[model samples]
Target: MSFIELVGLHKSYGRHTVLQGIDLQVQRHQVVTLIGASGSGKSTLLRCLNALEPIDAGEIRLDGDVVSGPGVDVNRLRRRVGMVFQSFNLFPHMTVLDNIALGPIRLLGAEPRTARDRARSLLERVNLAHRADYYPDQLSGGQQQRVAIVRTLAMDPDAVLLDEITSALDPELVAEVLNIVRELAADGMTMMLATHEMHFAREVSDLVVFLEQGQLLEQGPPEQVFGDPVEPRTREFLRQIVEAGRL
Candidate 1:
């Protein structure tokens, strides 16, 4: 069975429909990149996957379990999914160690010492062991974002949703976060990323999904989507992004 599945998913904010009939399947160990212009529903799609935003219609399943159906246990479903955002939402007053440890301690009922240990290991994974005692304001934007990634991973989730995690960083800093993601991909982490970095998406993702106006336009292997796009809309979108130096 696929690791993550979304069938006919629909979402809206009163009158504004953000996603319509979205269907996707992410196999275990696969990296799928969702790319589109702003307001195209990429981020909304990611948010709905984790139940951060409720869907108006359709179903989301993870590990063969229905997570979005009526009466589902949302908390139980969320434990297996983790999300990282563009803002690097770390607590300003907390040290990096505590920032990473908070979720495990609160949500998973981990002991303080055990959570601290797991936080340290995750920090090491992101190569931020030396910054564990530093506060968010003390580190560069890149470092803080790495901390955010580790913070999410400390939960040991089965799937990670990256919502343009590098979008808020300096141009030079973007590489640092993308490198960590590349490493995770190499290690077979199952991930779904909403990204503007076309080059990295082509290099790191197993599949590329193009969304336009809250609908799926095209999806396929990275080569087919990025190298030889079949749809006119995909080609036009790629051309614009490439010319803007965002690809």
Candidate 2:
């Protein structure tokens, strides 16, 4: 079985359906990228996987265990699947070390010192150890985003869902945040990301999924999907991306 599976999934906010009959499987250690125009259900898909949004129908499974729908332990599911959003959702009042150490100390039952040490190490990995004493508002967008990623890593999640993590960063700062993700990919971290950075997506993803108006239009390896797409819609999307100098 795949490490992560979504079978016949459906989700809606009232009558406005955001996802429809989506079926996807992600293997362990693979990096999957979801790409398309805005409002293509990419973020919703990731949220469903993390149980941040409950599916209206179908099942989501991780490591052969069902994780979607009611009665599932949302807290437990989240511990295994961490998510980073477009906005750096850091605690403004807390220092970087405290923000990164909170989850491990509170939920994972690690001692305070141990959590702080691990947090510091993660920050060091991302070249943010100097910012450990700084607050979120005191750092640049890139540094804050890096801290957010570090916070997720401190939990040691089985898989991570990144929702347009660089969308909120400035043009020059974008690379700094993306570099962290690239390193994670190299380290074989199982991840699924929603991103508009087409080139980075093509370069790092083992699988690229195209979503359109709540449907899975096409999905394949980067070579096949970006170089030789089967769907006309997929081709047009790439054409637009190219014309816009995004690819």
Candidate 3:
């Protein structure tokens, strides 16, 4: 069985269906990227994977066990499959170190001192250890976003979901955050990312899934999906990205 699997996943917000009968499998330590237009269910899929949003139908499985829908422990699932957001979502008053350690201490029950020590190590890996004492407001957008990513990592999740995490950063700041993801990928972190960064997707992904509207239009190796997409919609989408100089 795949490390992560979704079977017939469906989600709706009122009458608007955000995801439709979606199915995907992610292998252990693989990097998967979801690419699509703004309302194409890319974000919703990631949200559903971590149970941030409820799925109206289908099931999500981790290690062959159902982890989504009712009767599931959402908190337990979340600790295993953590996510980072476009907004960074760092607590305003907490220092960077405290923010990263919060989950380990509060949720995973690691001692506060141990959590902070691990947080400092993660920060050092990302070259942010010196900023550990800085508040969210004190760090640059890039630094804050890196802290958020590290915060997700501190939980030692089985896989990480990233929802357009670089979308909120300034152009120059974008690379800094992306570098962290690249490093994670290099270190064999299993990841699923929804992104507009076509180049980065191609560079890091083991598989690229292109979403159109509420369906997955095409999925394959980056070379095949990006260079010779099987579906017209996928081709068109990449063409627009190319025309916009984004691909």
Candidate 4:
């Protein structure tokens, strides 16, 4: 069975449908990248996976446990899913260490010392150990995002959802954040990333999913999806992004 599965997922905000009948399966330790134009629902899909945005229809299952569906306990299900956003949503008043430790302490009931140690290790993993005592306002954008990632990792989630995590960083700083993610991928972290970085997506992802107008247009290994797209829409989308140097 797939490690993560979304079956016929649909979501809407009032009358506006943001996602429609989306189906995807991500295997263990695989890195899947979601790409699409703005307002294409990529972020919304990731939000649904983490239960930040509830689905209007269909189901999502993680490790065979239903996370989205009738009667599902959303809070309990969220413990297994972690998300990092485009904007680093760290608490302004909290130090980097406290931000990372908060989730493990509150959600997993780890002792304060234990959570602190775990947070420290995660900060080290992201190569931000020196900034552990700094508040979010004092850190660079890349550093803050890295800390956000560590904060999510403290929960030891089954899958990490990255929604354009580097989009807010400066061009030079984007590489640093991507490097951390690359290291995690090398260690076989299970991740789903919604991104505009087509080069990184092509090189690092095991699978690439292309969405347009809230529909899954194509999905396959990177070579097939990006190298020789079978769908005209996919080809056109790739061309536009490539010509604009946004891919």
lDDT of each residue in 56-89, candidate 2, tens digit only: 9999999999998778999898999999999989
Positional deviation of residue 17's Cα in model 1 after best superposition, in angstroms? 1.3
CA shift of 64, model 4, Å: 2.0
Listed in order, each prediction's TM-score against the native is 0.97, 0.99, 0.99, 0.97
Global lDDT scores for all candidate models: 0.93, 0.95, 0.95, 0.90
lDDT of 2: 0.95
Candidate 3 lDDT tens digits, 70-149: 79999999999999999999999899999999999999999999999999999999999999999999999999999999
lDDT of 4 by residue, 113-227 (tens): 9999988888888878888899999999989988988888888887789999998999989999999899889989899999999999998999999998889989999999999
RMSD of each: 1.1, 0.6, 0.7, 1.1
Candidate 1 clashes between residue pairs 3 or more apart in a chain or in different chains = none
Worst 10 residues of 2 by lDDT: 68-77
Question: How much is the lDDT of residue 204 in candidate 1?
Answer: 96
Clashing pairs for model 2 are: none
Error of 3 at 82 (Å): 0.7
